[model samples]
Target: MRTIAIGDIHGGLKGLVQLLNKLEVRDEDELIFMGDYVDGWSESAQVVQFLIELSQKIECVFIRGNHDVWCEEWLETGEVNMTWYIHGGMETMASYDDFSDEEKKEHLAFFRKLKLYHLDDQNRLFLHAGFTSMHGVEKEVHKPTLYFDRTLWELALAMDNNLDTKSYFYPNRLKHYHEIYIGHTPTTNFKCDIPMNAINIWNVDTGAAFKGRITGMDIETKTFLQSDPVYTLYPNEKGRNKD
Candidate 1:
C-alpha cells in the first residue's frame, strides 16, 4: 500500500480532483491531507462534501488549518472578524449560499470534529501549521496549530526572511518524528523546492489557491508530484502573489 501526503486544498475542488485523478489512488493506498481544506476558492462547500465522501472510501487523515478554525467560529457564532472574512472566509460563505440550514449544521459539525494533528505509524507528524517550541506549550494547543498566533507567526516570518535556520522551533529536537509535514505558509517562502524545512519543520503548502499547483509527497520514496496551476490570482500570473 502506497502512502501519499497531499498539501493544502484551500477550497480548490477542481485542482483537488485533478490531482487525485492523476495520482490514480487505489483502495489500499493511504491518503493524508495536510489541511486548509476550505476557503480561497469558489467551491469551499463542495470541497468539504468531497472530503466527507472520500473519507468513507479510503484511509484519510484530515488535519485542521487556520482557515478551518475560522470556519468553525463562523458556524458556531454566526459572526466572524474581518480578518477571517478577508482571508477567503468570504469565498467559503459564498459557497454555502445554496445549502439548507440542516446541511450547514452538519458541515459545521464535521469541521469541529477534524483532528488538530495526525501521527502516522511511521512516526511522521502532520499538522496544519508550525508548533510552538516554548516549554510548557501543550502538544495540543489549538490556537497556534489552527490560527497564526501573532507572536509565533512573527517569529517564523522573521526566521524565514533571514534564512536563519537556527531560529526555528524544532519540535522535540526533530528526533521524535522522522519528518514533520505542515501547511499554512506558502512554499514560495523557500527557493528551489516546495518542501521547506526549518529546524526540522517541513512546510508543504504550494499556494494552490493563488494558481500554484497542489503538491503530493511520497514519504517512502521521498519524491513529490505537483499538479499544474489550476487557479489564478491577480498581481502575478504564476500564483506567487499573496492574495
Candidate 2:
C-alpha cells in the first residue's frame, strides 16, 4: 500500500478533488494531509465537509495549521481575528454561511481533533509547519512552534548538502527523523510550483491559496501529482492573490 502526502489545500476544493481523482486512491493507501485545508477560495466549508466524509472511507491523517487554529477560534468564539480575516479567514467564514449552527459545531469538532504532528513507523515526521525542538517534536515546549516555526525549513535550506549526518555539526532536529514533510510555506515562494526537497525535508505546499496547484506525493517514491492551478478553477475570484 502506498502512502501519499498531500500539501496545503487552502479551501481549493476543486483542486483537491482533481488531485485526488488523479491519484486514483485505493482503500489500502494511506493519505496524509499537511494541512491548511481551509481559508482561501470560496469553498472552505465544502472542503471541510468533503474531508470529513473522505476520512471515513480512507485512512487519513490531518495536521493542523496556523490558519486552521484561527478558524477554530472563530468558529467556537464568534470573534474574528483581524490578521486571519485579512489573510483569507473572511472567505472561510463566508463559506459557512449556508451551514446550520449544528453543522458549524461539527466542523468545529473536526478542527479541534486535528493533530499537531504525526510520526510514522518509519521515523518520518509530518507537520503543517515546523517544530523547534532539537531533540524532536515530542520534546517541543511551545505548542505553536509545531505549526508556526519557519526556522526548521530555513535551516534545512541553508545547510550544506555535503554535511555528514554523523558529524557533530549536523542539526539534532534533522537527525531525529529519516525524512520530514511540511506544507505551510509554499514552494511557490521560491519560484517552484512542485514539491521541493531541501536535504531530507520535503515542502509540499505549492501555493494553492494563490495561483498554484494542490500537490500530492508518494512518500516512498517521491513521485507526485499536481492539479491545474487553483485560481484557474475559480477564475471569477482572486483567492488570496489580491494586491
Candidate 3:
C-alpha cells in the first residue's frame, strides 16, 4: 500500500477536495494528514465533515495542530481567545455556527482523538510540527512544540548527513527515525511552493494559511501533489496573515 502524507489544510476544503481528486488512492493506501485542518477560509466545519466521510473509505491518520488545540478548548470551555480568532479561529467558529449539539460533539471528539504524531510502518515520523524531545515516542511530549517548533527544521537545514557530530542537537533531539515529515512551518516562509527536504526532514506545509496551496506527498514514491493557490480558492477570505 502506498503511504501518503498531507500537509496542513487550514479549512481550504476546496483545495483539499481538488487535491484528493488528483490522487489515485487505493483502498489500502495509508493517508496521513499533518493537521491544521481548520481555522482558515470559511469551510472549517465542512472540512471536518469531509474528513469524517473520507475516513470511512481509507485508513487515515490525523495529527493535531496548535489551532486544533484552540478549537478543542473552545468547544469544551466556550472561551474564545483573540489570538486564535485573529489567526482564522473566527472563521472556524462561524463555520460551525449552525452545527447541532450532537454534531459539534462528534467534531470535538474527532479533534481530541487526533494523534500528535504517527510513526508509519516505514519508520517515517509524521507530525504537524517538530518535537522538542522524544523518548522512543513514549515520554511526555509538549503539544506546543509538536504544533509550532521550527528548531528541528532549522537544525536539519544547518547540518548535512553528518549531523551526529554537530556541536548542538542533543542525542534526544537528534534524528532517530527514517525521516520526519512536518507541516506547521509553511514552505512560503522559505519562498517556495513545493514540498522541501533537508537531510531526512520534510516540510510540506506550502503556506496554505497565507497564499500558498495545500500539498500532499506520496512518501513511498516521493511524488508530490499541490492544489491551486489557496487565495484563489477563497476569493472572499484570507486565512491567517502571516506575512
Expressed as tens digits, the lDDT of each residue in 26-123 for candidate 1 is 99988888888887777888889898889899988887778888888888889976887878888888889998988889889888888777877877
Tens-digit lDDT track for model 3 on 16-74? 98998888778988889999998878898889989988999899999988889999999
The residue pairs that clash in candidate 1, if any, are 211-231
Residue 13, model 2, lDDT: 96
Say which candidate scores most in lDDT.
2
| Cα-based lDDT at residue 31, candidate 1 | 86
Select the stronger candidate by lDDT from 2 and 3: 2
Q: Judge candidate 3 against the unseen true structure and give its global Cα lDDT, from 0 to 1.
A: 0.85
Stretches of candidate 1 off by over 4 Å are 134-172, 191-193, 197-199, 232-243
Error at 100, model 2, angstroms:
0.8
TM-score of 3: 0.92
Q: How close is candidate 1 to the true structure, as a TM-score?
A: 0.81
- TM-score of each model, paired residue for residue: 0.81, 0.99, 0.92
Model 2 collision count: 0
Clashes of each: 1, 0, 0
Residues 84-192, candidate 2, lDDT per residue (tens digit)?
9999999999999999999999999999999999999999999999988888999999999989999999999999989999999999989999999999999999999
RMSD (Å) of each candidate, 1 decimal: 4.7, 0.7, 2.2
Clashes of 3: 0
